[model samples]
Target: MTETNDTANLIQEAEYFYQKIFAAPVPRPILEKYIAANRKKMPRPDERIRNLVLKKADIEAVEMAWRFKSPRNVLTKKIHILIYLAETTPENFSLFFNTKNKRFSSFIVLAGHFVRSMGKFLKGKFLLKRYNLV
Candidate 1:
């Protein structure tokens, strides 16, 4: 069916976008500074993860939180976008909020990322360059 195909395409697009954000490197110094300032808020609270992050792991501490932590894994960079949409978008009204299903939650998160990233792109922000995602 056309609807099924559309959903599949959207999921594929979301996966691509997620991979781009995941693989994008954060500057070591910048990430370190963020960790230093925000360690109290970080999950896991493991000194080993902390040390690995300080040693410049491929992913930032925030990314590590997603890969290693639960419930918190549902939290992504575009959570603000999700909140905004839940508050404002009529089409998505009563949807995508407080979702417990990981798959649906991931879909909402990716949709949020897509919306925010598209907005930035429209504003002439070179996202890949700005985030060093390239």
Candidate 2:
């Protein structure tokens, strides 16, 4: 029972992530239909079912082709911190890589540096103006 619930949750999370990467609309109604019926089963693609993913084989092929880990894997914990600071969208995150590699990590670092510099500049300007009045 516990494993069933855990699998269901994993399927739900995977579907959500798939929605982010895919251009197709989510098959929420179809997923809900299966979830309601079995309550303990994950959705397996069938002709009648509206599969949110492209296909199982397609996903497997991509996984096999790119077995390499993401460059920012080292900063997994700080990733959220960087993402929160960056103005980038999820759609563009994968495309962020350049010839140098780890573009998103570089972008996050550059963004943090720029923000800190901008803050310092603003504070200096404010202090200069506020000194005579204060």
Candidate 3:
């Protein structure tokens, strides 16, 4: 019963992440730029479902492919990594916000994410200020 509940929770969490990240339509400019750069087109709906099936391909390889893909969109890459990690390695994904882990490496990883998030937040703030929209 516990195993079943855990599986349900995992599925729920994965679905939540998928909806939040991938459901939104990409901005037109970014989509055009991505196409112009010839980066991997965002996976088709069926392709996404197929990739999530563990019986098909190794998830780590999938994760690494996204990781090394064009660095032109670091934020999107990071979110994709997070989604993959959430789907395949829930423990590791939890570690991104976990405070109980005493491991130095985990702390470093969390700190790195925090820094990146703050950087993006500040950048947006600056842009808003420049346009007098904030």
lDDT (CA) for every model shown? 0.38, 0.38, 0.41
- Candidate 2 lDDT over residue span 53-128, tens digit each: 3223232222212222333321121223223322144443554545566777988999997886556545544432
Supply every candidate's count of residue pairs whose N, Cα or C atoms clash at under 3 angstroms: 0, 0, 0
Task: Show where candidate 3 strays beyond 4 Å.
Answer: 1-44, 48-55, 70-94, 100-134
For each candidate, give its TM-score against the true structure. Answer: 0.21, 0.21, 0.26
Better of 2 and 3 by TM-score: 3
Top TM-score prediction, candidate number: 3
| Highest-lDDT candidate | 3
Tens digits of per-residue lDDT for model 3, 38-82: 234432222232234423323333333333443334334434544
lDDT of 1: 0.38
Model 1 spans with C-alpha error above 4 angstroms: 1-101, 125-134
Clashing residue pairs, backbone N/CA/C < 3 A, model 1: none
Give a tens-digit lDDT track for model 1, residues 1-134: 35454334333323333334434343334333333323334322333333322343323233433433332432233332223423454544435455455787789989997886555444322322333322
